[model samples]
Target chain A: MTAVPDAIDQALGIAPGSPLHALRALRPEFVSGAEACRAAVLDPEETLDLSPELRRAIARRVVAGAGHDRLTEGYPRPADPALAALADGEMPEDFALAALARHADLIAETPAKAGPEHLSALQEAGFSVPQIIALSELLAFACYQIRVVHGLGLLKETRA
Target chain B: MTDTIPQVTLKPLTWTPHLPPVEIEDATPRQLEAMKVTPSAKKVSPYVRTLAHDPDSYVARTVLFNAIMYAEGGLNRADRELGALGASLINGCKYCANVHARQHARLTGTATTSALYAGRRDALNPRDAAIMDFAEALTATPPTAEQSHVEALRAQGMEDAEIQDLIHSIAIFGWANRLMHPLGHSD
Candidate 1:
């Protein structure tokens, strides 16, 4: 049975039956696990107070900030101007969205520099505990996805 | 908890979460299900409990992480640990680095870990250095890993499958370091 390619394969342009696709096929668990993770982060079964639109905007913001433009290319621009600002790398004027954007940049760029104060800031901005955890996962997943995508792109170049 | 944050070290460290973790007694059924895969059979650590606040993502993360680091075949276990250690080192995730350093040491020896902790990549053997170099490049924002990095691993006799495994090891830590570093401090 031919296994369908997951999001990572699509992002890296790894065509079916190609050498790189076969290389990925060697680790089916990693490929499937990654896609599952993408779903959990991007469109969770329970989003709590964090909406799916906001999550996508945050994902785009972080990935774009990380310079993996390809990852954000497929998502249509958010209809909400505030979310559009976020996807464009501008901090929204809303207190909570601004805090999320700031934290997203910190996690994507210099995570080691983050501290208790950052979490406190999120709390003060009215993010519930679950929401904060969800946002962290979102930021983290974006960073992970970019690294995987970029790493695979390099591998593709190597084989080309 | 002191106000100070810990620096990167090979010594094992304690991680203190900035947010209060969900108490086990207060955990929901879903949270408990996700916590199943976490190292919480005895006493749940603050890190695992903190992650449990978001159950679905926590579950997905644990599955993906295990698949990347512990899946057999392709890269051997030791080099996968080394790849994780290298990425953790570059990302400055002290807790993750300390954990993987011990794993790498247990699997191999402490020479490469010591060299990495001491900022002495030159001290690593050719294969170790190549892995470290590739990990560092791939860990960089925008990821500077090149075809030459792949060729270097190839020169070390790593197959494409093995190299992909190594890449997953390093890349997952990019995910892990973001969470572990930002959500807490190691001391």
Candidate 2:
């Protein structure tokens, strides 16, 4: 009888296939579901009020920073130079105040900082309420991806 | 100039969400598929629809979410909801905390969640306390969640499946809290 491997096995490459390829073995439904979340966040057709480049930049920042310490690739590459810089954790001169604040919030560098004052500051920077919400989701979704990828990466590291 | 210290509330306080939901207009077939997995009763929530920009991913997330949350024969709903509420608090999503807390309260008919929301840990039963401690720890950045958390759960008489369910419950909130916190605001 074949012992069924856990998500950690397939996701971390402790099994026969690469992490990306091995993930199908754990539970196809979960792998597919997680991929779908990636497509929506990093590669979407909807012209987000926030551009795809900017969205990817946030994802880049999150993946690089999340604790997994693996998951170094698979993030969308931004074409815009400013976005590229942001993705690399640089604040360019033209960076939007709203974006900088949110990058701070999602990066989780200082948890207590993301309170009413920060929200008000973004509002004062001229973001409409809905846009602020969208930005929040974008950054948050980035963090979500970091966790998923990192979790899978961890499973790979300990595959005995 | 004298510095004024910010006042921290010591009493258990209630949490509520007050964001206006983003409403779906066309109800695209793909969007409809996504809505089925959510708890929404009518048109899909704006948040779900917004994510439907990539309908494939939306379907995938919804499917996974439903399995983790509504699947039969795992940890009971209220306990799972408590895990969610605990994670939401750590993530600072008042809206998610309110929604899941209300769900837990409604299912168990208990209103003691105020203390849980306010960061109080003294009065909880061993089970709820164990679950919340693990949830909050796991939810923290860099994840201070440790093997001791698991040991504490075992000591509380959680079987393997229940412990696995609890981990999934807390882990899913790690994903869910980040997604929902930015989608809307709550009181």
Candidate 3:
């Protein structure tokens, strides 16, 4: 079956049937999800009103993505001594993967405790759900970019 | 004047399985009371209470809650519990991990708390596994998340709005993971 277009593709001008399409097609749920997301972004009240099932599905996706990424990026590789040490239950300087995952889950589910002003600011800034997702992607990319630059010695030198 | 030789001593850092737990005695009675009375019934340790009490300054909490409640499309109790497990696993906060894992085990009657604490994927339900993967990506790597990454979840029958909310959930968790790493008490 042909995969549905992703909201990112629709928002960012990526064409359907391109690599993005193929990638999104990898997950059947994601294909239909992209369609639903497109509708929600297009019309929040009418199309994307929150439902219990939708919420659960969303939570599942977010947690899965984050968990996969943490395993790949945050931890030491299998060949590394650090990895072995960690697996053996040694305390690393940083937080463990499990703790991070839990924290991420909690943060994602917390309600909008911000005052009227911040909420208004976000709304005024055209912060729809898709836009928020885009921002998140942007932030992640920014962190990655900073790490790349720092690794390359492009960042300013600081005293240790 | 004769030059004196400088002496340098290297102290080897020892790795410990557990951190010295944060002491309640360090907190004031009011703070202790707040910790005791917080809604979760999970004692908000003094450190978490310190952060929660200053609700105005804890921007992360507000943003995270909104993302979970509104952007993530409003997770149910089970979903929230699962999300909590996923985040705790990724962050490796022993205290939080132990607490949430126990809760998850109690609720789901599946994986043991130890397995969850170890980040053992095999022990989790398939849906929970998928959610865990999503949470890790959102927390650890955003830009590298290929279109396929999202598609995988969709292939599993997730809807579009749900996917968007999922992203929000990850974003919120990502923010929280960082905050808790340095500021939260786990000992």
Candidate 4:
């Protein structure tokens, strides 16, 4: 059997040749592109002034907040105690990390509720424009991954 | 330019970025490639340019988005567009909502779009209602989509592949809305 080559499949435990796996195969680009996107957002070539550890921690926080405990496993807490605390949803004492956590939660929970003031807050906390964009991408990816996982879980349960 | 999320509309809308967009002239070769700005290409949208600040993510996102929304042979474009509209509406990303609403209208008709904008799912046909219902549920935070949602789509005659298509189309907007809504506002 072909190994489950996609992250979504691995996350969901989709066996090769399973019906859901076949369904995913119908659109190979989405599977591959999603992997690429995962890499770009989670472990990008450029950190955009946001450290890789902070990004992973933020992703864990957002995914955990989305209530995907299983998905949270994919993003282990960072070694640094502060980063680990951030991943656990504790508000960091650092103003910048705290600000980033709040922004991540807002975007993950209620994207529509976000506004210009949110970006301004990031700026005030010392995030540059590129850093803000990179942060947004990470938050966006977490939100997207949660939905995909949830949607696929439904498919597996009902259609399996 | 409006800083607030607008009500869903069919009218053409513009996106205003909260952060400064990458200056196209000063763009690195990677950023330019990610934006797909060839010599003959028309002007890129501010959204694209702004996103290009992180070229790797931008390129990967674009590739995934195009495959989910524009690829052939699973769900039809009109249905995928409706799925996009449903997620956008729920997320209150007026910019994404407006774009997909227009696409949904063009490929199908304005009836479904009108119904969705008016918050009247009952007015939609059973198939569209099922699709929209699933879209909203899946797009919700912590996602309320259940087995019933899959069953509903199956009952509407959507194959597993088509339902998969619908899922991706709706889910991508969750990503899109977060980026678009928070990073910028629509006018």
Candidate 5:
């Protein structure tokens, strides 16, 4: 029986065994930030029993991670009216650029080299201590995978 | 919060080609000015701006529009408002919550919005409650929602077209809520 954090209990409505709970069980030092983010972004099935504040916190974390470079990358770069129309007034150029830049940085940062700045950002965004730890752990794992992939030239190959 | 009760007035809006116009002739001058000030009051993101061209054509407004216009038996404005509120609540979108809740309060009165914000879906009348429940399930766990959910709404006297519109409203808000949540705070 794992002791679940109160915030997780409050946000998700269900007790432990929730996806968020699984995320919490992993130790932060053992994992990495990028991995956690990748999982959160790619795994749509993952349920987050996030409170309004926590949800805002996650959004803030993603936003902060998305540095200024990513913020300005507009969709269709030069500008495609059709894509813009499909954006349906949702995707703005500046916002896209910012998000892209941040995601790139997060992907570039090494897990072993990560510092308090990363943790502090999540904390300021309203992540419970447990969630912060879990995210860090996941990020470490992601970074490890990235390193392996980069070494093998797998990432570049896949991109090509 | 002022405990002093503000006088409640009913001002029905009629739909126009571009947006629905709020006729506030019965509202106090202050209230009317406040309404006019809402759009220009803040610098909105490109996302929000595109959704709301006029005061009445907001994303939530468009959702309600489609719901009322295309629903089978047709949903009343109040039901559409409640649906928006329920979806916003499920998505955990404070901005949408603020917007939809205010509209709900304006149309259905403060008491109703109070009950909803308090998380008391059962307290609402059966019809409205069903709509809220359906909207919540749809937004929170879309794939898991079953046919019975739609059937339950139909049993409550909603038409197929109305249910389709309701589903569309829920789906649309799911996307809109995510966009707003992530981007709303930004300049």
Candidate 6:
């Protein structure tokens, strides 16, 4: 069996059969850098103020926004009803963070279709400037993880 | 299909997405704690701060983001910005397109960033066009975009570092466009 690729290996496509072909991991620092990035986001043991559940929730919404079909591609996402609701367009008024995160996912899935209205909605939902920024980054990061997994997944397929 | 993208000057675009406008003064202890460790540069952009819901990932992303675009080596800022513009264009991320186009314009001058954002790849110079071609293809379809796209970069006189930088720029936007698209609008 092939060894599970590390975060750097996955991001840089450095495992058994990266699609890059012929190019070794360009810089070890880059690979480690990417690994640290992924771990910081996904790892539960890190020194972050955000809880793991919230991180997973954001991940789930991001994956849902991008496409649930990608779950098989090694994308990490959480499973939550509140987040699911937001992904589809319904932001619950009570749980502001979940609603905000859902809004962020919608922006991720349909960025081109987004407008000030969405932002206004978040404000209405009680998100602040920093909160909005955080939500945006996490929502955007969901795409990053999904895209990275999808890209690396393709490389894994090529290895076959 | 020549759509017109709004041309903002050499500054952050107008009308950023306005979330519910909750004064952060009421922020809970967790939010405040996250704020303390959040990247200092991100403090300036409300967009980056939106990730406060998931602070750890926020820090991770910031670190990765800084390293990718602002790190010591590999791709230069200009080429990286060009790659970002290309990916943003393909991903339909007006916010990212606007932001990176302005960045690209700052480095290379002559805002072809608008042209690329408008999806008018045909209007670009050969080199810029090639970078766009590769970035878009990679963004839209990474697996299908591998070998040939890399080769095309080579054909465009891109050295290994430039090619790598271009790939990171494009790939990162694949995520960035998704993120910003969900958060707000640009034009």
lDDT of each model, Cα atoms only? Answer: 0.84, 0.58, 0.38, 0.86, 0.40, 0.58
DockQ of each: 0.66, 0.19, 0.03, 0.71, 0.02, 0.27
Q: What is the Cα-based TM-score of model 2?
A: 0.68
| Tens digit per residue, CA lDDT, model 6, B118-150 | 556566777777777777666653223666665
Q: Sort every candidate by lDDT, greatest first.
A: 4, 1, 2, 6, 5, 3
**Best of the two (1, 2) by TM-score:** 1
lDDT of 3 by residue, B38-157 (tens): 445655444344343322223223433443534323344444455555654565434444554555556665443444445455765566666666655544433234445555655676
True contacts kept of each: 0.77, 0.19, 0.01, 0.84, 0.00, 0.38
Best prediction by DockQ: 4
Kindly provide the TM-score of model 1 when superposed on the true structure, using C-alpha atoms. Answer: 0.93
lDDT of 4 by residue, B1-187 (tens): 1222223447899899988899889999999988888989849889999999999899899889999999978899999999998999999999899999999888887777877777666678889999988999999888999888888889989888888889999999999988888888788
Candidate 3: list runs displaced more than 4 Å. Answer: A1-160, B1-45, B52-55, B63-76, B112-115, B141-143
Worst 10 residues of 2 chain B by lDDT: B1-10
List the candidates ranked by TM-score, beginning with the highest: 4, 1, 2, 6, 3, 5
Write model 1 residue lDDT over A1-160, tens digit each, in one string: 1366577876777778677787777888888898889889888888887878888999888877556555777445699999999888997999888988888888888887888899999999999889999999988888888888887777674442
TM-score of chain B of each: 0.91, 0.78, 0.57, 0.92, 0.60, 0.78
Q: Chain A structural similarity (TM-score) per candidate?
A: 0.92, 0.68, 0.25, 0.91, 0.30, 0.59
Between candidates 4 and 5, name the one with more favorable lDDT.
Answer: 4
Residue-by-residue lDDT tens digits, candidate 2, A90-159? 6666637335645455435444235556656666666665455555545655555444444334333222
Q: Write the per-residue lDDT of candidate 2 for residues B1-187, one digit (tens) a residue.
A: 1332332222233332234433555556655665664445674455665555445445555676776687677578998899888878888766677778878877875534755654456657788888888787766775666667767877887654555556556667776666555444443
- Please say which candidate is ahead in lDDT: 3 or 5: 5
Per-residue lDDT tens digits for candidate 1, residues B72-150, read 7779999999889888877889899889999988888777777777666666789998998899998888688988888
Which DockQ-derived CAPRI band holds candidate 6? acceptable
Residue pairs with clashing backbones, model 2: A12-A156, A36-B57, B16-B187, B17-B186, B18-B186, B22-B46
Q: After superposition, how far is residue B183 of candidate 6 from its true place, in Å?
A: 1.9
* Interface RMSD values for all candidates: 1.8, 4.7, 16.0, 1.5, 20.5, 5.2
